[model samples]
Target: MTPSPILDLAGLTLEVNHLGRGVRFYSQVLGLELRRHDEAAGVAEFTVNPHQTLTLWQPITRQANDERLAPLRPRGASHLHYAWQIDPAQLEPSKALLDAHGLEWQEINLGTDDRPDPTLYFFDPFGHGLELRGVNRDDARQPHFPPTPVQRPAHALPVMGLREVALAFGDYAAMKERLPRAYGFAYAKEQEDRDFAQFTLGPQAEPDGNGTPRRWLYAWDPQVGLADMLGGDHALVRFYADVDAVAGQVDAAGLLSVRDEQGLAVRDPEGHVFEFVPA
Candidate 1:
């Protein structure tokens, strides 16, 4: 059977070591609002956009044997890194907030091929690397590239949209094949030898209605070192959408959960780590 078309890029979920601590850090530093929490489920969710949510699941005692909660001794897995975009005007205020909270951050000027391109880097309380990009008004207001149809929701508000995601795989080809099989991602394009590929997912209808599909880019760079750089395997990006739907796909893919509670850090048949989230 054909897979259901992806509604849009959803948000990502993480399994944090301490749910309360993570919630405090993200809310204060990122200005996120807590949308939902279930102590019984050991889950807490934060909203970055209307449809996007960042979920934090605490380790359940019953599932302690899962590798996601394995003791960090020798060769333990690392936390995931995330990138967020913010308006240029909010950069200083946001940075100030972090400083007042005694949070250490690294200001980075990313040199891009385009004009007005710079990004700042910082770590969360848990030492997860994060990038804050200043959106170029010209670029943000400019028409979308490839000019695909877009349908605006009724109640529009500021939210973080998913841009792209990077995947690291020991075997690239196998991971590529499983994506289309599990998710409704169509083969869009591929870069030779660079081990990079792009996939498109969306509703089959036009932009005016509720059936618009989303786009995703999957990248694999074996040469890139995560340990010496950001201290993670790869990054998973999700756009604005429902959290449950995104999680559904992750479950369908049968990828192994990287975390003990909420997040899955499953490697596909090709040995690529796929980070699934709500868009």
Candidate 2:
């Protein structure tokens, strides 16, 4: 049980083709508070929680080709599969938020009586497959960090924060090896000789447990049987860690990664990008 330098699931950057429509859906529909926006860069930041952020970036071809951004080329993919954390009490109400806005959604149970993984699934205006993963807690426990009060719009879903980011790629084999060897992620769960895997960087996998907060990165191939992938699969997942350490491992593992004025970044075999910055 050694300590993990990968501090937290820092943020997620999504490919928001239209900045205004994407921002409106997340703000008015999901209730994420707007934190920062650089119109010139076509980027908008929303406060998901004290430790996590959800960013919407409209790819600026000219800006990305600029001398400064070209090296990193920071961008996100469309139709990425990701999840948001919410309490069980707020689960049913979340469906209402989707229906009230004329958005179609589905609810599913991935667990049994002993461990019920209740989830609400839906899509944003831009078609990113979003899931409201429930935090099923039977007893009260101390949280890893103090809760921050964020003022959200009335139409917002009762989302706690970014819970899980699931990426589907063809090169699951390479990513399965790359995630742990380079980033210190340990296996949480995996199926029999399967293409899907779960890796946990923090103590517990959710707010239900006591230690540090948990952030999830799920890697799976298309054959994993997703109802709908929304015609694309990939993500830009960020983490706060020792950049030197991440860079060191990237070299040791012989991973093709980018290091610039920002920090260390890498695109995986299936196009999902991982960015490592200073803690």
Candidate 3:
């Protein structure tokens, strides 16, 4: 079956070591607007924009009272990374802002057979990687190449608008069923058993005759020796924004992490790992 066009990229929730410190870093350095806060509940939400919102909450605990809210030391490797897409034009200004803040960054051309433009990469205050790309409105309207004649995909949507991402979960099957029921993501196909399952987070239906169905989710295979293949351990988180504005803001924060062809790495205040890549 054809997949639907994604409704929108939602915010992410992560366990933090220090809720206040993490919130401060995300709000101040990332320029995310605080939308809501529940001190009594020890939960807060930040809006990246109208469509995306991030929430920071204390780790799950059984203790009663304020003591439960106390931040705890991170227990695992901070190898996760998240990528946010921004407008291409804002790249230099954003980079300058990061420089003003004393943050370091590295650049690379993300040219591919399908796309040959430059994509800038950097990190957040914590060390999550972010990437910015320039995608014109017209460019987003072009039909998916290796085109399907019967299906005329929506022309209004823009490319690089949070196309898709992978979310790591302990119970893959549970999430596989729960996400679609709660969020509207439809099961597309399994990339490789439970390790990685692809889902259609969008509403754009694949043409009836399309050769292979379009997939949204790419589940990770824990069994695979990913660390060994890369020579080190790594993790990922993915975020989406107006391709035009994200880079400049990231650069302005001056907390960008640098890296080689792979891209820079950064962590959230609580130490969750992530890497930024352009959509």
Candidate 4:
């Protein structure tokens, strides 16, 4: 197999129906530092982990053609799902924090039979499903990636980093053929049946060992997400990869692509928007 130039999943964008409520939930409730907020454009950015971001943009229907985000305005995916890695030491504490905020959540093990990764499932105010998977700091795929600096009660649910973004595909075959071809992701070590497949990317630190990649794009059945339709018109996933090479692969595969100063953007058969920028 050829090497995938995907350095990392730089950011994931989710559409928020209400910018104020979304901002409050992420900043006040989740404790993520509000790095930037463009009130005019209704866009907010939150810092995640050592080098990642969680962006919420409430697209302005009338002025959706803003130059900065033209063609693909800041609109994000709805009812889409993603996961954040958190310190296992704070599992119960995370649950308690959710309770304190009156946020209902459920726990499930999302690991192998031998390895158990306790995960908490919950929803943000905009109905975006989120997960707080219990993880050890050392379990970071990249050892250089250290444990997150804790901040006691204020930042109780310290998210180690963004781990996975799950999407429901109306047509899995086309995605399986194009995603890896354009971005160079590979099938996971094992299969969770045939209908669902996860493409792994970034830092293969222990590819030959039990270590898992930090970036995961899960393509699964439609029943998991409500907004899942034949085309995913609401989400945008961007990555730090070899944009030129990715663009080449994308074109070679006969997929439609649009390039700009920042990077390349492409829409898949499912209406999923993906952007590739220089790493």
Q: What is the lDDT of candidate 2?
A: 0.69
Give the per-residue lDDT digits (tens) of candidate 3, residues 1-279. 533323334445544556677677666556666787665555677765444556665544664222221242222223233334444565566576656656666665555656555555555444334444444433333323211111111221111323234445555566566444432345656645345666543455332111122223444433332212110122223332222233333355443333334333334332333333333
lDDT of 1 by residue, 1-279 (tens): 443345455555565677789887767656577887766656777776555556665667754322442332111123545555455565666666656777667765555455344555666666555666555444322212222212222222122443334445566676577666554455667765567656554433222101112334444544442322332343334333233444566678665544333433444444334444433
RMSD, candidate 3, Å: 15.1
TM-score of 4: 0.85
Worst 10 residues of 4 by lDDT: 204-213
Order the candidates by TM-score, highest first — what do you get?
4, 2, 1, 3
Lowest lDDT sum, 10 consecutive residues, model 1, at 205-214
- Give residue 276's lDDT in candidate 3 (0 to 100): 35
Runs off by more than 4 Å, candidate 2: 1-4, 65-69, 113-115, 136-151, 203-213, 223-227, 230-234, 258-263
How well is each residue in 44-155 modelled by candidate 2, as lDDT tens digits? 9888877778888787866761244345444576777787766767778878888999988887777777766677777787878888766533333323332333556678
Per residue, candidate 4 scores C-alpha lDDT tens digits across 1-279 of 566766667778888888888888888667877888887887888887646788887878687523644665435887778877676777788887888888888887666679776678888887778877654545556532333654534644666677678777777777677677765766664355556666665534223123243567777756544222222245788877878778888888776667889888876667677887776
Specify the highest-TM-score model's number: 4
Deviation in Å, model 1, residue 254 alpha carbon = 10
> How close to the true structure is residue 12 of candidate 1, measured as C-alpha lDDT?
58
* Candidate 4: segments with Cα more than 4 A from true spot: 72-74, 112-114, 143-147, 150-156, 189-194, 203-213, 225-233
Q: How far is candidate 4 from the true structure (C-alpha RMSD, Å)?
A: 3.6
Off by over 4 Å in 1: 1-4, 63-78, 109-114, 136-165, 180-182, 186-218, 221-279
- Local distance difference test, candidate 1: 0.49
